[model samples]
Target: MYDRKDPYYKKAKQEGYKSRAAYKLKEIDKKYNLYHQNSRVLDAGCAPGGWSQVLLERVKNGVVVGVDILEMDSLNHPAFHFIHGDITEDETVERILEISDKYDLVVSDAAPNTSGQKLLDHVNSVELVQKIAELTRKVLKKKGTFLFKLFEGEDKDMVLKGLRKDFDMVKVVKPDATRKNSFEIYVICRGYKGEQG
Candidate 1:
């Protein structure tokens, strides 16, 4: 659990960010150069609008469309659109496309609720991440960027194997904002090459 007095939590409040998770993306983007000022971005599993909020500041005139099964307090920006639906559904993809044909970057900080059984939690996280990856295939532009979080497990290699064909480089990183006791790792994929025949 996040300590209310955690430095990041306090920092978030002072900085006007919706959640302390905002720092993770800020740190990741600084290292990876994830999105451009005029880029189109899709933020899946976005709620409370922290990552989406950061994207809004960074994208400038670009657009950020966030989707989640949980209702998000609407982001008050002309360039920000929220799709309140499960990203695994066809309807969500259709709604995302209605805003733009494709996105220049797709990011997901979303994770499945952990049940405390490490193996069970890891398996569930991988499955949810795979579904998000499928969404990336549908909405990401050629040569786009894909970033997401996953629970570390024995099956992570299999996930990486599938991504090798679709992206030029795939790497995993743990940001400082993540609780040190946490098992979550962020996968950063670049140079999307699209589906292999």
Candidate 2:
């Protein structure tokens, strides 16, 4: 039984965070030791700005550049930057590249609007993540990190095998904050060796 106001949702409201997704990022970072005080990050599909908020807090000096098709409410921090555009588009990628030569980390919580059919949803999610992976390769630094949300399905292993070629280590995680009924998982690709085109 998944409640609309689940524990994570209530905690986000009480803690002044934008969404429950913030906790997912927090728990993943705690376990993985992904970021540092100066890690440049690219936040793809970063609307509502929850992950970007965590990035800004964790990486005190390095910049956080968030890009999305939908407009995001401003986060008024010195190192935080936002782009109102689709991350998959060349124009948006150009804008992002203009922001920084390379990013130490790239994260996305993007997903296609679900139609309630699980298999179709999973396929769409895989395609979306693959597109984001391409964008990650273009922007991420050679020893960079990549993390993104993915809906589980049969083809996920194919995705993992592909990522393994690009990253030295790749792991899929389901954070405690994630609802038990939700099929979504997060993929962490670390030590990017730039193995892909």
Candidate 3:
């Protein structure tokens, strides 16, 4: 019951992409130069595999590890690895850490399920962003990059403030592929300072 004929949706189908969300990442990377030829990447909330596909194309020789609670069809590339489980769990974190010591880039497209209550939804989104930030701290290498989506609300500013403490550059980005009516924006942080004194 969605509009399969939407221009982006149609373009995704033609290009063999798993979802139209791929274009969002494409635009972000185009503007930010987030990818390198050999960048170890971690993708959280990566169901349906669009973002992982983009990472695979861009990272070429580096590792791409994607994790989510939902099942995803295997991406089937030597450089690509998928884990099925909640990313917040210790077991999942261990599994990911076992594969790579640290990541050069961490990207999360995670979003909480909205209940149509604006205040409650915003609160939940803020919590989810905090969780992702914690995970990024644990897994990302020093001077790495992070790109995660956050819904606009009062807490958005607070989240940005927290991120600025650790990253040399923290920016808010709304890609062209984002819906005009949506409240979502991506927080891009680079030059991670790491979790040590």
Candidate 4:
């Protein structure tokens, strides 16, 4: 949990960002430069619009489409669009495709509602990440990038191996904004190799 007195928390509030999670993307982009002006981006599990705000600022002339199961209040950014639906649903995918044919970047910060059972949580998280990866293959442009959040566990190796088959470079990254005690880490995959037959 972020302490209200912490510098990051204060900075986020002062800067008008909805949440400190915005810094995670900032740090990742500092390393990967994932967003480009006019790039098309898909943000999965976007809620409260923190990451979407950062994406909007980075992709000046670009478009950002964010999807989440929960309703989000209006973001008021011309470049940003939000869809309220389950990303795993076919209807959601169809809606996303209607906005753009190929996306340059796909970012997922999704996590299953935890049951407080460690093993079960890890398994569920990995499964969700895999589902996002599969969706990335279908929607991403050739050579697009995928960034997703994952929890470290025995199942992580399997997840990384599957990602290796789809991306030329796959790296596990832990941003400074991520809590040290948390098992959460972002999997950064660059250079999509096309759909698996």
Q: Which candidate's TM-score is highest?
A: 1
Candidate 4 residue runs with Cα over 4 Å from true position: none
Q: Which digits, one per residue and each the tens of the lDDT, describe model 3 over residues 71-127? A: 989999999988898877888888889889899999999888888777888899899
Off by over 4 Å in 2: 1-4, 195-197
Q: After superposition, how far is residue 9 of candidate 1 from its true place, in Å?
A: 0.9
**lDDT string, candidate 1, 67-121, tens digits:** 9899878888989999999988888899999999989999999889889999999
Candidate topping lDDT: 1
State the number of backbone clashes in model 1: 0
List the global CA lDDT of all models: 0.92, 0.90, 0.90, 0.90
lDDT of candidate 3?
A: 0.90
Taking all chains together, the TM-score of candidate 1 against the true structure is 0.97
Ranking by TM-score: 1, 3, 4, 2
Write model 4 residue lDDT over 73-140, tens digit each, in one string: 88898889899998888898999999998899999998899877888889999888888887888999
Identify the runs in model 1 with alpha carbons over 4 angstroms from their true place: none
lDDT string for model 2 (48-131, tens) is 888888888878889999988888789999999999987778899899999898999999999888888999999999999999
Backbone clash total for model 2 is 0
